[model samples]
Target chain A: MKVVGLYEYLPIEAQESFLDVIVDTPKASGHDLLVRIQAISVNPVDTKLRASKVTVEETPRILGWDAVGIVTEIGDAVELFQVGDAVYYAGDVTRPGSYAEFQLVDEHLVGAKPINLSIEEAAAMPLTLITAWEALFDRIRINPDADAGKKLLIINGSGGVGSIATQLAVWAGLEVITTASRDETITWSKQQGATHVINHRKPLLPQLKALDLEGVEYILCLHNTDAYWDAMQEIILPQGHICSVVELQNPVSMSLIKDKSVTVSYEFMFTRSKYNTDDKVRQHDILTKATQLFEKGFLKTTLNHVLTPINAATIKEAHRMLESGKSIGKLVVKGFEENDEQAN
Target chain B: MKVVGLYEYLPIEAQESFLDVIVDTPKASGHDLLVRIQAISVNPVDTKLRASKVTVEETPRILGWDAVGIVTEIGDAVELFQVGDAVYYAGDVTRPGSYAEFQLVDEHLVGAKPINLSIEEAAAMPLTLITAWEALFDRIRINPDADAGKKLLIINGSGGVGSIATQLAVWAGLEVITTASRDETITWSKQQGATHVINHRKPLLPQLKALDLEGVEYILCLHNTDAYWDAMQEIILPQGHICSVVELQNPVSMSLIKDKSVTVSYEFMFTRSKYNTDDKVRQHDILTKATQLFEKGFLKTTLNHVLTPINAATIKEAHRMLESGKSIGKLVVKGFEENDEQAN
Candidate 1:
């Protein structure tokens, strides 16, 4: 199988950062499904894992999480999917990822792809869709019925996770207030169903106040958590909830939220797969629901950029764009290069 | 009205730390109720507020929260209670508290006292009951039916809030594992229906492992949050919830729970009342339900010590015991002194 992989961690600019290589195709067993990659998306996690540490791997390390693919084979215990099924998923972070022509994924984590969308469009939805879904419904536990008219503040609403989160929040009947600094990003945020767009570069509280909102009932922070921690504390209503996808780099004074009786949660999309929790199948359920929403026209794909002929060069370019911190929405790489396509 | 109040913040041992003085009786208006105090209980909040700062007050500031009293008057807008109704409440912290012969409380914060319990017993319950109830049912949002048989760890099993939390968790059909060091506290924890009693003085993970338990689904931290932050993270199940009433004195690394996708919340009993939130009336509903549970023998008051004559001297003694950190259950003071009785 043709794969884009790395032997050692290096800057994206380096020629050896990512390499095109031939690896033996893996077999599906137990609950696993052998998926032929159709398209894969680059997220912050891809770039982060690519350059996180300085260690040489004995074998090439694959580094993609989000993918839209066709199941070519199914394991003995697999019941959710069968061969020839088009599926989409944010695969497990602990094992080999979706950076290869043939990738193995647990059947419990794979969802039927939205038939209405193209391969690249479906690939862009999985990781961000799963993250945004879990952050709001699972971690923060917002009720669509009970909290219908309540306000939700999505920080960095033009980012990958934020773009999907704004749409989900609005679809759940919440009034979405999102943050975006640049004109393009602000317009992008509005396009994603944000009811109001504030500038993240300015003080968030003043911007929210200008929108006639005293505080939000919920906050989904998709940016630097440490930088926005204090502002979130100030702008969250008493007894409100805050869910962040970003990890804090420094110790924070948690007591600041005590008087308001606030709930703060972290939504690491990989937690279920990494912990091997009993409810790991929930990822499949979330993606299936997302597919329905997309097909029903309640949701639209956040794919903003696409590169053809998936190879080391294209993957590196996607990583470089993500690392630049200026990329809007999701970037996807589709199809194996014609020369490498035969290796699959 | 005769009240135990302070002009300035001082240590419990100081001569003028608390003074019995005659103040004009207050009137009930809006959602307020004027109650004639029968008994008042001391909590850690009483001691913490008494010496929190060293600013002189223009008027004497009374300090107490939990009270069992008879409603002597009701405001025009008060519909929850009528005059002469025996009520119990953890009144608003921003208002003058129950350390007086006559106290005014928001009707929404008051509940009909349990007919089965004595005044001092009922007085011992309100504050801690509200704290524990809010931590479990509101903050953690544990569903009794769905989460039945799941484990919940209470950090301090013998203290006021811990005692009730243990009982509540048990009543909700959860397996309660609580922390207690001394033999007396351990026995007391068992009395409160704790399934297991572990020592908080030692590392909690090893103790839990000794019982063949890997982790708990929920943790209610009643002790120091900063000290237990790491242990809570280590001992919580993936996607578990943790609620704490203790405020952290120092900044702590919150990102430690990111990998587990843990939800951490602060449950301040005063939040609704302090913020004047629309859901302030939820406290009344909780206390009303608690009263029924007590009357039905599903719950019991945790009063372990009592002082006669609600006066400055008794209040000082109560504060001293709470600040010493060795007091078990709850300490309550009953009635006004004969000499001070005429003031009301």
Candidate 2:
């Protein structure tokens, strides 16, 4: 199968940062689905992993996570998916990724693609949707039907996860307050169902105070956690819950929230598959719900940009755009070139 | 009314550290209940407050949170209790406390005293019970009935909160593992219903490994958070929850748990009272349930040491014992001297 991978970690400016290569296609076994990748989304994680390379690999390292594909083969133990079914998933981090023509993924992490959306649109959602879903429902344990009158603040509301999180939180009946700096991004956040918008470039407390919000009941941070640490400590409600996707560069004072009894959780999206936890199948359930919601008009894909001919050049450009840190929503690469195909 | 209080922060060794004073009894208003104090428990917070006094008060500053007393009068708005009702409560820290002949407390924070225990015995439970109850059920959101086959680790398992937390976790059907440094403390931890006990004075990882345990699903920390932090990071299962009652003396690297998506929460028993939150009445509900549990023998009072004739001298001595940091379970004082009381 044809693949776009890296032999050594290098900046996007390097000509050889991403390469087109050929590798033996993996076969499905033990609940695995051999997927024929059709489209893949580029996220910040892809850029981060590309830049954080420490050791040179003997073989090219594939680096995609979010994909919309068709299951071409299934393991005997597979129960959730079958051959020739359209599927979408943010596959396991420990395995070879979806940046290839053929990839094997655990069926438990795969979900049926939304019938109303294109493959590129579906590709943009799996990773960010799973992240936002787990952060709100699993980690924070917010009951969509019960938590009325509560409020949520989404930091960096123009990002992929923030776009989906804003809509989901609002659908769950929370008064959503989102942060966006640029005018276009602010308008996009409002269009995604944010009840209020604040600028991340300015002091959050003053903006929140103007909105008559003393402290938010929930905060989902997609931006720099260390930068927002003090603000989160001051403005989270007593007994509030905070979930962040970003890693901290510096140590944080855990004692800051001691008096208020606050909960701080990390939402890595890959924890279930990384740990092979007993409830790993819940991811499939979450994505299945996402499909139903999307088909019913309760959700729309966050894909804002797309590139054709999934190849070294396009993937590198997607990574560069993500690294620039100005992209509003998800960016996807689709359509394998006719000359790049090594298999059907 | 006669009271024992401090006009300034002082070492317990000082003869005038605690002084006996006379003040007019406070009247009940709003949600307040005027209680005639019968017994009180001394916790580490009391000793810390005594040692860290920074400001001189014009009037004596009374400090006692855990008390078992009779409701002498009820405010017009009080509905949970009427006159002459025997109650137990960890009173608000903002109000003048129970180191007096009579004290006024919010009725929402008071609970019916357990009929099966002595006054001093019941006093040992209110504060610690609230802390443990909130930490497990409210903060960590552990469903006592549903979390079967799971495990919990309680650090400093012989301390006031740890002692009660151990029992409550066991009652909730969790296999409880606790840490105790001394032989007596270890025995006390076992007596409080710990399924297993380890020494905290030694390295925790090796001890847990020797018990054939890789990680725990839930961890309730009653000791120094900074001290046991690394061990908690290593031993908490992926996506596990950890709750601590102690404030960290140093900053913690939040990035350490990023890969595992761990949740860290602070469990301050006074949060509801401190914030006057909408769910402040939950504390009263917890204590009421605790009374039933204590009566049915599902839980037991953790009071380990007692002093008679509540007075300035005895309170100062209690402070001395607590400051030594060697006291096990709870230290309580009861029955004021005949000559000290200005009220019957």
Q: Which candidate number would show the highest DockQ if scored against the true structure? A: 1
Off by over 4 Å in 1: A339-344, B339-344
lDDT of 1 by residue, B155-267 (tens): 99999999999999999999999999999999999999998999999999999999999999999999988899899989999999999998777766666588889998999
Scanning candidate 2 chain A in windows of ten residues, the lowest lDDT window is A335-344
lDDT (tens digit, per residue) of candidate 1 on A107-220: 888899999998889999899999999999999988998999999999999999999999999999999999989999999999999989998999999888888889999999
Which ten residues in a row are the worst by lDDT in model 1 chain B?
B335-344
DockQ-based CAPRI category assigned to the predicted complex of candidate 2: medium
Q: Model 1, residue B185: displacement in angstroms?
A: 0.5
What's the lDDT for residue A15 in model 2? 89
lDDT of 1 at B134: 95
lDDT of 2 at A218: 96
lDDT of 2 by residue, B1-344 (tens): 88998888988888779999998888889889999888899887787777756789999899999998889888899999989888999989888888888899998899999999988789888999999999999999999677976999999999899999999998989999999888899999999999899989889888989999999999999888989889999999999999989877776666558888999899988889989999999999999999999999999999999897788999988888888888889998886787325222
Every candidate's TM-score, chain A alone? 0.97, 0.97
